[model samples]
Target: MKYANNIAAIDELSASEGVFTTAQAQRLGISRNALSHACKVGRLERVAHGAYRLSGAPSSETDELAAIWKLTASTAFSWERQAKWDGVAVGGSTAAWLLGIGDFHLSPYRIYAPERINSKIESARFGVRNVDEGDMAWMGGLPVTRAERTLADLCLDCEDPSLVEGAFRDAAAQGLIDSTKLGSLLDELGESKRRAALLEPLARALSASDQKGQS
Candidate 1:
């Protein structure tokens, strides 16, 4: 089966680097076998089972991370699609990036969805956690933990208490999350005593930082 037109279209879109799949080839009026042949001939590079990226494009660590996140979100579980269908937002580490809260330090990007969907999807690719409805909000067209919840989640999982403190301080300084909200999230998370203990101090520090900022 000929794939000259498909190849041309792919090459045009990926002048630098882009991703596509065998299914996409069929959608574009090309044969899957032809697409596979193109990959074998070094015309395409297979990044995952059904995903391919252009060969010889400048790839960076950030690009690799983003690709991993995309793959994990797409294949690791159905919760992501469920969240979209339910009109819930789903983002966490990525949200922190947008909110400028602080660096997430290799933490898995989080997704927030409706309570009805079970959020457990384990993979070596990335971490996924479910947030309650009240704490979920939309960010960049995806559901994510609210700013306060994000800060609390980070505090619960981060290795360095100081980093969590810094994030809380930054979020408060920027007025990205309210101090009262942070306290409430910490309180709500109190069932996990260890987590509450770990984050309470950071919350307090953030309150102090907010005061200093106000002054």
Candidate 2:
């Protein structure tokens, strides 16, 4: 099959690092048949279900992650859901890795969403949780947990408390984490005794640092 290049769609993809979704194409008045024709003619590459990258466009390190995120809301373009993007984001150790604050990586990428996700992909895992807008940040055009929240999640979910401590130190050194904001998150997580037990050491460390600064 032969087709003309969807110049308008390509222009839109260029603005978003050569990535676009089916819904986005439709929004530009390109039909599914047109998109499929573009793919067949080497004008586009389907990266995931409903996600595409312009053919020959430079690939981004975050392309796979971004495509996966788009699947969480296959019907809505990313910019249209800026209010929170359905509360979905990269999270846990994966988030720390993206933020460059930890020497940790999970085999299955960790993603958090407001509701349960039954993903069939072997390389991704999903967790159901509510994330506040303040706890989210942008990285490579995808949403991810901020440093403070990522550390707090590690403190609660990681088996090795030392790993959380190390990540916290790294983030603090890079000025990516605010001690005051972390303190509040710790207090909020401490409401659960089990969580408090896990977070106590970090909380104490933060307190000692505050005291030393005064002295």
Choose the strongest candidate by lDDT.
Answer: 2
Model 1 scores worst on lDDT over the 10 consecutive residues at 118-127
RMSD of 1: 5.8
Candidate 1 lDDT, 83-135, residue by residue in tens? 54443343445556656776663335444343443433332223344566667
Candidate 1 pairs with clashing backbones: 89-143, 90-142, 90-143, 90-144, 91-143, 91-144
Per-model TM values vs. the true structure:
0.59, 0.85
Q: List the residue pairs that clash in candidate 2.
A: none
lDDT per residue for candidate 2 within 47-100, as digits (tens), equals 877788987888876676777787777667676667545789888888988888
- lDDT against true structure, model 1: 0.57
**Model 2 CA deviation exceeding 4 Å by range:** 1-7
